[model samples]
Target: MSNYIVEMLNIRKEFPGIVANNNVNLQLKKGEIHALLGENGAGKSTLMNVLFGLYQPEKGEIRVKGEVVKISDPNIANRLGIGMVHQHFMLVDTFTVAQNIILGSEPKKKGVFVDLKQAEKEIVELSERYGLRVDPKAKIRDISVGMQQRAEILKTLYRGAEVIILDEPTAVLTPQEIKELIGIMKSLINEGISIILITHKLKEIMEVCDRCTVIRKGEGIGTVNVSETNVDELASLMVGRDIVFTTEKTPAKPKDTILSIKNLEVKDSRQAVMVKGLNLNIQAGEIVGVAGIDGNGQSELIEAITGLRKVESGEILLHNKSITHLSTRKVTEAGVAHIPQDRHKFGLVLEYPIGENMVLQTYYQKPFSNFKVLSFKNIYQYASRLIEDYDVRTPSTRTKARALSGGNQQKAIIAREVDRSPDLLIAAQPTRGLDVGAIENIHKRLIKERDKGRAILLVSFELDEIINVSDRIAVMFDGQIVAEVKPEETNEQELGLLMAGSSKEKAGEL
Candidate 1:
């Protein structure tokens, strides 16, 4: 009998112009958490999709428990005890948690109507068994992102999945939630369920995974035992270079305030007050990073500043000129650039080509257009320059934005927003799903922009990023700016406590 629970040998998958996976091999031992580590476009998701039966591999042999099997579709994969939780969740916002969990594989009553109460009971039992605390009665739209992810996992378990694949699972979770997820994964393994984790976070792999398989540029680099390997070696194998953990920068010479907000109040789509009575300022040649747990008014504040969300009552001044209640276009014209938190929702048009998305901000002016007629020649030329300058790995500028990897999409947005050289740049979760190398490059670029006298407002859940990239850090708690501190003087533990509503004095005491 084979010790491996699953084996994919010499997998090859291809798109129209790109060979996504080439001779990639993966072997999963029974009940072990195997990590798939790679760069942004290094074909991690493509390989997982093949395993989940979302894509057909041109050449490969998959063996489950020493017997070869052909998984032609998701239903087949599920029947064969496989399930996948995608990076972007596939849950219905209008459905309740129990309804979403038992969506497809629902329980029946007397061979008639759907038995929702039984489903809820089973879901509650499963959640408790796996240490996943999710409310079955809550609506999907009302719950937090972490809770939504738990529902996704419960969906898999509800279908009797013995093998689970999680793609970038912690990319949107907070630190505490990530720790909880690790515990859940451990509990699942204890129950004899094997897991395949697809992520770019080396630290996560080191902490939870038993072994790792590294892929670079669509080919398998090698596999190593996590117990014997370190982060440096794994990073070098994935990125083909020695990655730098810290950013190089000089002390900021902050000039006059370029953007100021006073008594800002904003509401969410549900008309609930999210940002209340907030005050802050970003000076020229400085990066003011807002550090907070997710949903603590960070999203609303960014939306209010960039004109995406209406401010209920407050004043926003750019260059000492009031810009309150301005339209998005007016905000852009008034020298404000934004790298939005949700890239697909606000940053890029998925159906458009990468070249066109590059010129989204300035296409109406200058070389890109004349007399309201677009110049494809200048537009593509500009796109090509930024693509090369920012290391956006794409088959061509004509590729659809949806075809590119998440990190590349983010890079394209950063290139577009940063190239405008606006007076104030708002970067929200800029490096959410990126590798260490890409994060380093973006950090360097942001610093370069700061050096060029552009003020930046950064908001991130990664406490290390707030400390490493920002000159000044603001902690938000309960829709208000609770405290402002220099990054050099505080540590992540203190920041974490403050973000959780601990007073500065209490943080110091801890």
Candidate 2:
């Protein structure tokens, strides 16, 4: 009998005009956390999809406990104790945590109606056992993203999953939440539950995983124990080259102010004020990064500046002209470009072709359109250039935006926004799910724009990015700019203290 709990050997999967996975192999042992590392669009997710029965391999065999079996659907995979948590969560906003957990396979009352009370009791027990700390009665929409992720795990546990697949689990979590999740993974493994963690974050793999398997462009490179390898070796193996972690740039020469926000106040969808009397200024040829914990009114402030939300009381000036109440189109016309935090919601139209999405902002203008007549040739030609320049891996420009991987979709959005040469470019979580190589490229581009005398406002949750890329760091707390410091003078520890509302003197003293 094989010692492995799950094994996928020589798997091959293909889509139209692309080979997503070819001859990929993976083996997971019981009571271990195995990491699958790869670059964006490198077929890591495709291989896992095959294992979860979301897609069948054209050629390969799967073995569970040395028994060969064919998994025809997700239900069949679930029956075999396999459960997958996707990158984008699949929970309904209106459903409660307990309801979502026991959705398909629910406890019944007299074998008829759902026994939701019993389901909640079982879910509570399961969450406690794994140290997940989830509230079963909370609505999905009302909980934090970390809590929602815990609900997803509870759902898998409710289905009796012995093997869990976590796809980009830490991509959307905060630093504190990430630490908590690592603890939960350790506890799960202690109970003999195997895990396959798919991620590109090298630091996370080094910290949490026992072993790692590398894949490049749809082929398995090799697998190595975590203790035997360093981050440099793993990065080189994943991208076929040595990766540079820091971006190099010269000192900034600040010029006149390009954007000025005075006494800004904004509210969220729930009619609660998020941005409270905030004030900021950005000068040309300078990159000012906003560093804060999540839910510190970063999203609301960005929306107000980009004209996606109403500014209840404040003034937003671009080039010394007021634009507080202007429409989003007018704001864009006034030389302001935005790379939104939620790419799917604001950056791209998923149903459109990549070529069309590329020209969404400029399609009505000349070269792309003439007298309301569309020009497909020019649009596609433009998209092809950006695709090549940004290294977006797609079969063709005509491919649907949804067909591309999450990182590719993000690259497409960045390409469009940066190519515009706007006076003020606002980038929110620009490198959220990108690999190290892609991050290096983006940081270089931002610096290039700053050197070109453009004012850039960068909002990110990553303290490393803020310190490395920004000339000036603005620490936000409770919807206001509490402190400003030069990047070279500050470190992550001090920033973390300030982000948690610590006084500047206290931060410096500590």
Candidate 3:
């Protein structure tokens, strides 16, 4: 009998113009937390989708507990005790937690309707058992992102998932939530459940995974024991290069203030106060990083600056000129560039071609368009230049923006925003879901922009990025700028404390 619980041999999946997975093999041992490590488009998700029955592989053999099986759909995979939690959740917003969790596998009371009471009771028990606390009666739309993720995990476990697949589970979570998730994974593994975590975060893999299988450009590179390998080795295996974790750049030469937010008050779409009396200043030739836990007014502050959200009061100035309540186009015209936090939401048009998306902000200007008539020739030429320069891997500039991988999409946004050479650049979560190579490239571009006298406001939850990329760091807590400190004067520990509302002297004492 084989010790492996699940085995996918020589899997081959192809899409139009791209071979997603080519002869990729994955073996999962019983009762082990394994990591599927790779770049964004390196076929990690494709291989998992093949296993979860979302896509059929043209060539592969799947074995479950030493028995060969054919899985053609999600129902079949569920019957075979395989469950997957995708990066983007699949939940009905109108449904309650219990409703979403027990949708297909609901307990019938009278063989006619769902047993709501029984389902809620069972959900409570299951959540307690797994330490995934979620209100059973809470609506999905009203709950936080972390709670929704927990509900996703519960959906899999409720269906008897002996072998679970988690795809980038910690990407959107706060640092606190990530620690809780790590604890939950440990508890699940202790209870004899196996997990295959699909991620590129070397820190999480090293801390949680028992072993790791690396894939690069649709082919399996190798697998190594987590305890025996280091982060640098894992990074090299994943990206096929010696990864420089820290970006090298000269000190900032800050001059006049490029952007100033004085007593800014902003509200969300729901009319809730998010950014309250916030004051921030960014000078030319410097990067000012806003470091905070997620939901601490970062999104609202960025939106307020970019003219996406309404300012309830106060002012935003670009180059000493008031830009508060200006139209987005007006703000863009005033030499402001924004790489929004949610790429799909505000950055790109999914239905448009990659070339058209490249000139979204500047298309109405010269060269791209004249008298409201777009010039496809110039658009494609410009996109081609950016694609080559920024290393945006795509079939062609004619490809739809939706067809590109997350990292590639992010790269395209960076190319479009950075090429404009604006005076003040707002980069929000610039390297959110990219691999080491792509991250290094993006970081270099940001620093280069700063060196060229562009004032940059970087908002990121990644502490390392905030520390390494920014010359000055502002710690935000509860919709306010709590403290300002230089990178050289603080560590992650001190910054974390300040972000949580602890003063410098208190943090030092702690």
lDDT, candidate 2, 1-510, per-residue tens: 899999999999999988988898899998999999989999999999999999999999999888998998989899999999998999999999999998999899999999999998998889889999888899999999999999998888889999999999988898889999999999999998999999989999999999999999999998999999999999999999988888999999999999999999999999999999999999999999999999889999999998899999989999999999999999998999999999999999999999899988899998999999999999999999999999999999999999888899999999999999999999999998888888889999999999999999999998999999999999999999999999999899999999999999999888
Q: TM-scores of the models, in the given order?
A: 0.97, 0.99, 0.97
Winner on lDDT (2 vs 3): 2
Model 3 C-alpha lDDT per residue in residues 1-510, reported as the tens digit of each score: 999999999999998888899988889998899999998789898899999999999998999999998899989999998999998789999999999999999999889888999999999999999899999999999998889999999999899999899998987788898899999999888878889999879999999999999999999888899999999999999999899999999999999999999999888878888888999999999999999988889999998888888889999999999999899999999999999988988999999999899999989888998899988899999999999999888888999998887778989999999999999999999998788889988999999999999999999999999999999999999999999999988899999999989997897776
Worst 10 residues of 1 by lDDT: 102-111
Clashing pairs in 2: none
Best by TM-score: 2
Model 2 weakest lDDT span, ten residues long: 432-441
How well is each residue in 1-510 modelled by candidate 1, as lDDT tens digits?
Answer: 888989999999998888999999999998999999999899999998998899999998998888899988998888888899999999999999999998888889998889999999999999999988899989999998889999999899989899999999998888888998999999999999999999988999999999999999999998999999999999999999998878999999899999999999999999999999999999999999999988799999998988899999999999999888999999999999999989999999999999999999889998999999999999999999999999998999999999898888999999999999999999999998998889989999999999999999999988889999999999999899999999999999999899999999999888
Model 3: runs farther than 4 Å from truth? Answer: none
Clashing pairs in 3: none
lDDT of each: 0.94, 0.94, 0.92
Clashing pairs in 1: none
TM-score of 2: 0.99
